[model samples]
Target: MCAAYGEERASRTRINPAVLILGFKIHRSLRMQQSNKPEEQSASILRSR
Candidate 1:
């Protein structure tokens, strides 16, 4: 219920251009390692549920 809503919001926020740019920079800095911050964000959002 609320968890689903939080997940949706997290996905929406991550799709923002600013977040995309930040993701690109982070990916470059990590040399292409997978990103976990977004997952963490989603998790935090779920916790708020």
Candidate 2:
């Protein structure tokens, strides 16, 4: 039971980072088109997330 639970947790953790990274990249691209200051926008985006 513990091993099964660990596997489930690991799978979830792995998917979460990939999703976050993909979302961040998409958001950055969209924000880049909308604004010139990406550093500030990305910092705000990270804080908001």
What does candidate 2's lDDT look like per residue over 6-33, in tens digits? 4566567756777656656766777677
TM-score, predicted candidate 2 vs. hidden true structure: 0.39
Model 1 alpha-carbon drift over 4 Å, by segment: 1-14, 32-49
RMSD of 2: 12.4
Return the clash pairs for model 2, or none: none
Q: Local distance difference test, per candidate?
A: 0.62, 0.66
Please report the candidate that would top lDDT against the real structure.
2
List the candidates' TM-scores in order.
Answer: 0.37, 0.39
lDDT assessment of candidate 2: 0.66
- Candidate 1 residue-wise lDDT at 34: 35
